[model samples]
Target chain A: MHIPFDQLKAEFKRVLLKLNFTHERADFCAQIFAENSRDGVYTHGLNRFPAFVQHIKNGLINIDAQPTLINNLGAIEQWDGNLAPGILNASFCMDRAITLAEQNGIGCVAIKNTNHWMHGGTYGWQAADAGFIGICITNSIANMVPWGGSTNALGNNPLIIALPRADGHVVLDMAISQYSKGKVLQYQSFEDELPFVGGYDGDGNLTKDPNAIIESKRLLPIGLWKGSALSMVLDMLVSALSLGKTVKQITDQGNESSASQVFIAIKPFNA
Target chain B: MHIPFDQLKAEFKRVLLKLNFTHERADFCAQIFAENSRDGVYTHGLNRFPAFVQHIKNGLINIDAQPTLINNLGAIEQWDGNLAPGILNASFCMDRAITLAEQNGIGCVAIKNTNHWMHGGTYGWQAADAGFIGICITNSIANMVPWGGSTNALGNNPLIIALPRADGHVVLDMAISQYSKGKVLQYQSFEDELPFVGGYDGDGNLTKDPNAIIESKRLLPIGLWKGSALSMVLDMLVSALSLGKTVKQITDQGNESSASQVFIAIKPFNA
Candidate 1:
């Protein structure tokens, strides 16, 4: 139950190698998964490992694919993720953003057709570790209802902001929704109510009942209308900037792949 | 109650000139105030004009002082607001940011010692109107309690994001708090409870009673811990980037006069 970090990472790498992953990619990804768990994000760490493997086996992830430059706009660059592993694509993009920032004081990179980055904060940490202010956002499948709407029309998009500090990096990574579907399902499994109103029920009343919300599939956006509007704008930002699929497009395809994402790095004045 | 836009602007300009504002500055400020009202943001429009005048009269705003460049980091620039009008300073910073973005594909400007820009959305619209993506944030005096803390420690900092669209520009302007103090005061004035939980009562229980929340001074941040963390990081960002006052410092100063703000503009690929 308390495996050592190195052992966990080695196990992940071994499994990836068995699946024909190159030595470098396997080790890099294994370290990320291990770090995610060590960092207490079990949901995206070992717990999600099996799903990730399954997706790869189903050809949803192209292990050998690499992100290719779409266009260069001075300090901003657009990339096509080529359906590659999200971790690698995101990391590569952030590195590019940082390089651009080093040249221009601010850099932005938008990537399209990317897979799910297991932990969005990883890129934020990457930039902060490099002594730059970092911001990133990603759009997902429509999983939330728009404000004043009865049907799902928005993604509970995640946003990340990181500021490097002398003591410790200050990072704020949040999803627009009050709670993720995984969280709701966890509460339901424990037969416990949410501590706060998580979503709307079938009758359209705000509720803490996980089952009701899960059944209705109407997760509440954080701050109600404020979060709804925020989610919509973020979705627009990512998709438009990347010129990629929108939430509706992703949902219509019956999968959550080909997501659009943006990464930005700003050289702090001190830097 | 139904004054024409021109009449309202003229009246504001006349009053501002009486307070010794130059004709150009007075006209610009009055136009912003009138546009806020015309755009249905009464809180920051005519309703706030008298307070703006009072601040000027009290020497809180320096009409003659202009923002001066502190340093230019290529695509990013830092400025000292010289305790000038927030609206003018913010507009000037955004314009500079836009110009930088035009040259480098992205740009950022940070200003310190600025007053409150009446409506934060005004800057967002300014960028969108120029066919660019805009993002801005500003710190305020401490007003909301941090997560897991009973005392006031965080500012209800506002964030604005805007994207240009053919039909209409999509803009999101939101404070970290679920309900702003102004909104709560409005509800209290009408003897009406908030439509949802706005803040904590004196006993530390979430409540919709505006009077109790006001008395307790425990406004709830959006998404509870999430928003609290966001506000803290935003405060850290603006202050760290500008080397200006934090929420604690602003609160200690007994007035929200020398606030720090950041404006960012990104050139869209199509642009």
Candidate 2:
């Protein structure tokens, strides 16, 4: 059965309000979730909503918490997310970055202690809609093996870049892995092999068998060593800029929380 | 056959000076070429020196041109490279970015009309040596096929990111292509199949045979569609920022010259 967009959003807002979200916050987040589905990112849209609510129930996300400024260095700023809802914090940070970029030509905001931002493209689109170039990245718990290593030692960090145009904005949102863990599980549920090599098996040989990769927990990074290095560098950049938890630190806690993120906005030449 | 670094640099300087370069310019360019070899990037080092000289001889590169500021907007600046040497222009831009970042915590410099910057890692190392995080990218003539397309439609743009540390810096220099055109040619010459799928053959099937890919001119982008989108976006970014030539325009000229590039530097939290 197909659900109407407004109805989906209204339902989400109702649930969030029941969970103590302010009306404005609830409406904004609900719209984003609805838009994610509208934009065809179902994995991060309705499919992830139940888990998101559970996280709030478990205190992994604090509904009323807001980001607090830590430091400001001209075009660069840092903040503590204070365990706030990732969507709200991400939106606020990008808004701040756009404001700073309006004055400085370019601005960067790094935040620590933020939860998952659901769909990173939301922020990219946010900046693009404001007529600016946007770039954002976030680190997650380790879920992929580094090149030439046997165990999982790297996070499939996601990167987003958006360019504004009169016709249509160009946005790219990608993780460093060839296939995300979710995608692998999806393929495994259907008992289908991946179209390309996705990871290594227990024998340390490359394979396209999703089940083998899942069982081994050895997801392959995109472009082999190149993506591995990129992932590590991105993790370092976010953690260093925010003075927040690293991927290793988050992984060591045995749960994903308090992740670091960076958002940058650049005023276009025409803008 | 072993040559000392100083001797090689001296030889290069002699040749450049004979071609009417100023003493200082000749010395600097010679040192970078020698350093490329010292760093084991033989393709951009001694192996590419003859072509470099030929480009100068052919008037494709100007020995006396320098970058001139076009616009300055606080933390971001745009410059015209005036067809200057890529190494010199890239270094100068990065230096300017570093200075701006020092004053503003983050800075970006974009330039158009630059020539080929051999071994982009040189600039990454330069930034890290000065205790800053550096990120840079340059657009090139179309050399790889975009995902799902049957012809060459994208540049194998290189991206470089560097992070500073107390003991050793981390630097990642990568081209978006799974294997560079030069690497494919090398494998063909060696009569060896690629260790992984490198590109598509004339029949549009993925293959590890370097010869087929070289003949078909269908070098694959890293991570398939992901890198293809990334390469396109990087091109758009550099061109839009500098108001310079796009990959299509550069390829239309049937030669690689007057490329666009961007350099960014950020002050780390500790710094």
Candidate 3:
């Protein structure tokens, strides 16, 4: 099932072109998808393409709309994503942050009304490749129970950090959940149990079985209480910084768009 | 056992006065230690006081040496701590970052030759109180086994992030280890097994027994491979940004002094 990276990218580009995407847009999106698979993130790669297309077709994603500046606060800028493609908006915001960093050594950009950006690592790598350290995080619809609670009331809230290095840039992309939804689905495909405790089963016992976890919908928070606190912190940060939708607001919307996100870029002097 | 918080603060002040510390200096240091415990971080509070004294007594800490500027790169400034008490140096650097953020909307300070910052939350609270978001991280001597390796070659680096809020400023203080050295000691003292799987025993099997983990010194990285990569990224960031000692260098020095640290402060616009 492993296809050559170039072939995978070409296939993606072919589909995008057939969907009437501009050639440049199709090429860029295809390359990113290929890079995700090449870098060993299969969940965000080919496996997720169908869901992405479905979202586009459902009017959940506004493929042609672009982000517009809503406000500017000195070194910080706020943007409305216009419900555009998440990947494009994220990349644009990070680009703005890098430009700000080049002028001021540090810059932060926050965006609202964006779709899922697929792998957060993509923007992290983009910043590092441009010779800057980067950090980004996004809130999602509630899929986790708050600490000391027994119901879903929190988001997995993925976080990404990358450091620029002469050698391979070090990047970390993590979720507050022990296993993300995509990861749990991947495990379910094999009917395999998680190697470590993942989530709760029926009747509230910790279980490694992906199906049981999905059935119960109580994903274990990473580091138990620590992850819950961290997720709250990130949620507060994105919401407060961007003045955008919080996890609860996103949940109320009934779909996963219009989430809050923050991107920060810092550059070395020599850069 | 669970003494009133004020009594603990007074006791810490008494001990510092007995060590010939000036009255004001003693009060500042004691208040920080007490606050750490008040915020439920007992490991860095009363329990760490004796070791702080030991460092002072051994002439390893320069009680009166102040941080001095090394370089300034626009929004970023570098300082040399002169081997001062870790808490004092950390507070001073955070104050500098706060000042910079107030003027520029963002500020980053990196310090070399600094001692441990005690509870990293102290600095986070400092920035949050100043109406700025705060982030601080410190590299330590290697105490973690890298991914896919049995030998310890990574620092259990601590990262702190805090945001100002109308209710309580949300703060997250985390070490990269699944169980920090302090928590392990706590478990050992309480004669209780870890509530969940923590580190690995000698045979690389995950175990909840504190004694087995401490004896093996093979503490699990938080989130296994995820934390290993995060640790490496943080180490590289602290070292590279400050041009100070890396975890490898700190370990080779045979002790955990003269570490590298970074503090960042960002001001937010009115929502």
A131-196: candidate 3 lDDT, tens digit per residue: 999999999988888778888878999999898878788888888888887899889988888988
TM-score of each: 0.97, 0.97, 0.93
Ten contiguous residues minimizing lDDT sum, candidate 2 chain B: B180-189
Off by over 4 Å in 3: A1-7, A269-271, B1-11, B14-20, B201-205
Error of 2 at A224 (Å): 1.2
User: lDDT of all predictions, in order shown?
Assistant: 0.91, 0.92, 0.86
Weakest lDDT window of 10 consecutive positions for candidate 3 chain A:
A70-79
Where is model 3 chain B poorest over a 10-residue stretch in terms of lDDT?
B217-226
How well is each residue in A1-271 modelled by candidate 2, as lDDT tens digits?
A: 8999999999999999999999999999999999998888877889779989998999999999989999998999999999998999999999999998999999999999999998999999999999999999999999888988988889998999999988999999888899877778778878999998999899999999998998988888888888898899999999999999999999998878899999999998777
Arranged by lDDT with the best first, the candidates are 2, 1, 3
- The pairs that clash in candidate 3 are none
lDDT, candidate 1, equals 0.91
**Docking outcome class, model 1:** medium
| Model 2 lDDT tens row, B21-131 | 999999999999999988888778998899899999989899999899999999999999999999999999999999999999999999999999998999999899999
Q: After superposition, how far is residue B206 of candidate 2 from its true place, in Å?
A: 3.2
Q: Which candidate gets the maximum DockQ versus the true structure?
A: 2
lDDT of 1 by residue, A1-271 (tens): 7999999999999999999999999999999999999998777799889988988999888999999999897999999999998999999999999999999888999999998998889999999999999999999988889889999889998999999988999888888899877678778988999998999899989899999999988889988888888899999999989999898999899888899999999899887
Best by lDDT: 2
